[model samples]
Target: MAVYKVYAPPAPPTGGAASPEHFVFVRESFSWAAFLIPLPWMLYRRLWIVLAFYCLAAVAMALLAGSELAPVSMALGVLTPFVLGFEGNALRGWSLDRRGYTLEGVAEGRRRDDAEIRFFTRWVGGHAAAPQQPTPGPAARTLPITTLRETPTGIVGLFPTAGTQT
Candidate 1:
């Protein structure tokens, strides 16, 4: 099952709740496309800041590749895709947050649509219920606090009372 983090945009300046259409569901999992083609994936997601950082890293690595640290740069280049695959979704979520999106809740399902349906169903149902106040009741009695007696030196086992050594 896949888990998704649901994000809702900030309310409009007109003073009403944001539309459901604006809600975003970010899947919490490794992205194959992100690993295979990070540039296109970032472009599609509109993750400008992350893309910028990625470009900077790439440039740095490229510079290093031409120097004595070629092996280290090559290693980083190889690992970059795996890092993107794992953290791409998280970066998307961060982008959403930067755009004033608040984390609404988490949903789990086999697919995104299934998760969306399940989340909205529960969300609507919760909103439909009317809240009720608790009625006053008689005060309950409190239990008395008791202190245990200290065991004498060398005494052991579970006895009703502390025992002294023979």
Candidate 2:
């Protein structure tokens, strides 16, 4: 199953048709296209900062490799694109974050469309976590009270226990 990362676009103005259902799912797996065409992929995604860093790194590598470590530089040149492929999603996510996309959740499926469908099915069909319901009785009326007591094991507290659970 391919992992998918869900994103919610920035909320619209207070009066607009804003909704939780308007979510987008992008595959969180490595991109073979990005690996094969790093520059073009970066351009397509508008990953300016990442592209800048890549260019700078390439230039530095080229300058440093002049004649001393051609093989090392050659290897790095080949490896960089692969690294970009593996981290393409992260780069895209970072760009999305910068552009006001919030990470909502993650899911897995057979493909991007399938993953999106699964996420939406869960999100919109009541399969996701339900809102907390108010408990019955006076639990809501009274403020919770807690006390700490020293035990043979250690300090115990969140609830003032009359005794140990055992």
Best by lDDT: 1
State the lDDT of candidate 1 residue by residue for 1-166, as single tens digits: 9999999988899987888887899999998989999999999999999999999999999999999999999999999999999999999999999999999888899999999887887776223223356765677556665434443343445663445434
TM-score of each: 0.76, 0.67
Over 4 Å off in model 1, which ranges? 125-166
The list of candidate 2 runs beyond 4 A from truth reads 14-22, 124-166
Model 1: weakest 10-residue lDDT segment is 124-133
- Which window of 10 residues has the lowest lDDT sum in candidate 2? 146-155
| lDDT, candidate 2, 53-160, per-residue tens | 999989988986897888888899989988988898888888889988888778789877787766666664323554468777865586555543435543464644
Error of 1 at 162 (Å): 8.2
Give the whole-model CA lDDT for all candidates, comma-separated. Answer: 0.86, 0.77
